[model samples]
Each structure stands twice: as C-alpha cells, then as structure tokens.
Target: MSNYPINPSTIAAPHSQSPLGANISSASLTTEQEFETGIRIIRDAYRKKIATKDAEIDALYKDLRRRDAEIQ
Candidate 1:
C-alpha cells in the first residue's frame, strides 16, 4: 500500500492572485507535475515488487510439486 495520499484533500489549492501570481502559478504547475510523476514512479515500483513476489511464489509452488512427484 502506498503511504502517499492520493486524496484530493491532500493536494494544495492553486495559488490565488498576488503580485507574484504568474510566478506562483508556474511554480504550482511544476509542483503538481512533479507530484504526479512521483506517484507514477511509486506505482511502478510497487508493480515491479508485486511481479517479483508473484514469480517467487510460482517458483516455490513448482518446487513443491516437483517434490511431491518425487515422493510418489
């Protein structure tokens, strides 16, 4: 499970108008983009981890079956 919150409530509100409104908007956009990238990276990592675990489980099961066959 991801520790990162994907909830909308956790997202920061885009900056409101100010003297640096343009700069703030640009920065906010960058931050949001980075956040999305981070999520993708984390998600991919988890997928790889799951795949590796699944492969390990399958190998173990195969080994168990082989052992059973030998016993018979």
Candidate 2:
C-alpha cells in the first residue's frame, strides 16, 4: 500500500515492487551467475546419465532378442 513505508530491514518483507529501491547489487549478480552455472552443470550431468541408461537399455533389448532367437 502507498501508506506503508518500504522497510528493507524488517524480516517480514513485503513482496512489493518499488521503482526507486529495486536495484541489483554486484554481489547479487555474481551469486546469480554462480547459481546458473551450477544449475547448468547439474542439468548436463543428468542428461548424460539418462542417455547412457537409454543406450544400455537398447543393448539389453538386442541381447534379449538374440537369446530368444537362439532358444527358438
């Protein structure tokens, strides 16, 4: 509300947008970049692991078919 003074110190911070006070500090930007890099690394590792699992599944299916044919 316009009647409330924007208090930055209070732990009960209101999620209100202020044109004058909404400035990102250098430290905050650095921290955000680091977070993004960490997220990217984790995502890439997960994707590689999934691809490896898919390849293993394909190999297993092929082997199963070969064994089935030998039994027939």
Candidate 3:
C-alpha cells in the first residue's frame, strides 16, 4: 500500500465537557435565597402595577366628578 497519511479525525480525544444546566442541576438551581429574591421581584412588580392603577383610577374619578358637575 502506498504511504497514506493517517487521518487525524480517526484519533479520539477526551470527551468534551457538557454545558451547565443540561439536566437535573437546572431544577435544583433554586434555593432559599433565590426564592426570596423571586418573591421580592414579583412583589415589586405588583406594587408598581397597583400604584400605576391607583393613579389611573384617581384620574378617572376626577373626570367623573367633573362630568357630574357639568351635568348639574
């Protein structure tokens, strides 16, 4: 057989490490601190929404009062 160069592709190397959170670790990632942080985030969102809605409701109420006064 004529001298044929060995293919480098045929050589095997150590298995490459997999990306993180490819399995059960992802589910276990949450801990007590994370839970608290998530709760805080959600509460802040709701509080902001409530504050905005309160302002909108107050504006609507004032508009309604003005309409009533106009009618009178």
Candidate 4:
C-alpha cells in the first residue's frame, strides 16, 4: 500500500546486519520504455536457448530410433 518506490537508497540499512552500518548508494533508475525493451530482449534470448535445447533433444530421440530399427 506504500506509494514510495523501493530501491537501495530507499531501503533502510538493517541495524544489526549492515557491515557499513549505513544505507547503500542510490540505484540507477530505468524508464518504463527502457525496462520493457530490456525485458523483451531477455525473454527472446531465453526462448531461443530453450528452442535450441528442444532441437538437440529431438535429434537425440531420432538417433535412438534409428539405432533401435537397425538392431531389429
């Protein structure tokens, strides 16, 4: 419910755990457009990696099938 934005600067340095015993420096803020574009790029890269893995799995299955047919 708090309207305040959260970042390193806004966060309270935990009194008991902080080595510096102080809050961290301000974090770099990202614009909405920049954030969305970054997210999209990351998603595309992840999807591509998954697709490549799927293709490799399919190739392994095909090789197994071929070997089984040869044995039979």
Candidate 5:
C-alpha cells in the first residue's frame, strides 16, 4: 500500500455531536431563555437549601446543649 495508515472503522466513532447537538434545535429561542432562567432558579434554590440546612444544624446544636444540661 501507499504511505498511508489504516485505521479501524469501528474505532473512529464520533466523540461528541456538534455543540448543541440534535437535542436542541437552532431556532428554539424558548429553550435558550429557559436555560438561562433555569440557571438562575437553580442558584436561588441552592441558596435557600443552604439556609434551611444551617437552621437545622443550629436547632440540633441547641437540642444537644439541652440534653447535656440534663446529663449534668
């Protein structure tokens, strides 16, 4: 054969589809808007979740102190 390399066809599958891929149509404006909105919503949710968790931890600490006083 000429000065060329032979690669297996099965080994050359595509790594990834184009940036947006077939899942998102190029003309879908609502998808883009929702994506941005989703990012903001998730961020807000995370903040609220953290605040709730902190409140629970504080309550647990108070309960522990009350129980410790009973043990003394």
Candidate 6:
C-alpha cells in the first residue's frame, strides 16, 4: 500500500443533502453579525457585573476599616 493516508470522504457512504447547504453563504453573514452582537452584549454585561462587584468590595472594605478604628 502507498504511504499516503486514505481520505475518509472517498470511502464513506454519501450523506443526504443538508438543508443549510444552499443558504449557507447568505446565512453566514447574518450569523456572523448576530455572533458579534452577542459577544458585545456579553462583554458589556460582564464589565458591568465586575464594576458592581468591585464597588461592593470597596464599600465593605471601607466599613471594615472604620469599624477597626472605632475598636482601637
């Protein structure tokens, strides 16, 4: 046998035509736009969540310092 590996597609049975095959080109643009929009929304939400958490931690830290000074 030759050293070259056999291609699986050549040996595999034919698959039924996919529904998305014809519309893939057109669908890809819309899919990409949606994907980008989703990413932007997720990033914005994540940033907001982190900022809120940081603010909460800062407030708690300030309270702890004040309590410590009162005790002393």
Best by TM-score: 1
TM-score of 6: 0.57
TM-score each candidate: 0.58, 0.56, 0.57, 0.57, 0.49, 0.57
**Sort by lDDT, top down from the best:** 1, 6, 5, 3, 2, 4
RMSD of every candidate to native, in Å, equals 12.9, 8.9, 11.7, 10.0, 7.3, 7.8
Question: Tens-digit lDDT track for model 1 on 1-72?
Answer: 999779987776666433333434454455556566667778999999999999999999999999999999
Where does candidate 6 stray beyond 4 Å?
A: 1-29
Candidate 1 backbone collisions, by pair: none
Question: lDDT tens digits, residues 1-31, model 4?
Answer: 9997778876775443332212224233334
Clashing residue pairs in candidate 5 (N, C-alpha, C atoms within 3 angstroms): none
Worst 10 residues of 5 by lDDT: 14-23
TM-score of 1: 0.58
lDDT at 4, model 4: 72
Candidate 5 lDDT, 1-72, residue by residue in tens: 779777777464544333333444544345555576567778989999999999999999999999999999
Candidate maximizing lDDT: 1
- Show where candidate 4 strays beyond 4 Å: 1-30
Worst 10 residues of 6 by lDDT: 15-24
lDDT of 5 at 18: 34
Give the better candidate number (1 or 3) by TM-score: 1
Cα-based lDDT at residue 16, candidate 4: 38
List per-prediction Cα lDDT, in the order shown: 0.72, 0.69, 0.69, 0.67, 0.70, 0.71
Residue 55, model 4: Cα distance from true site in angstroms: 0.6
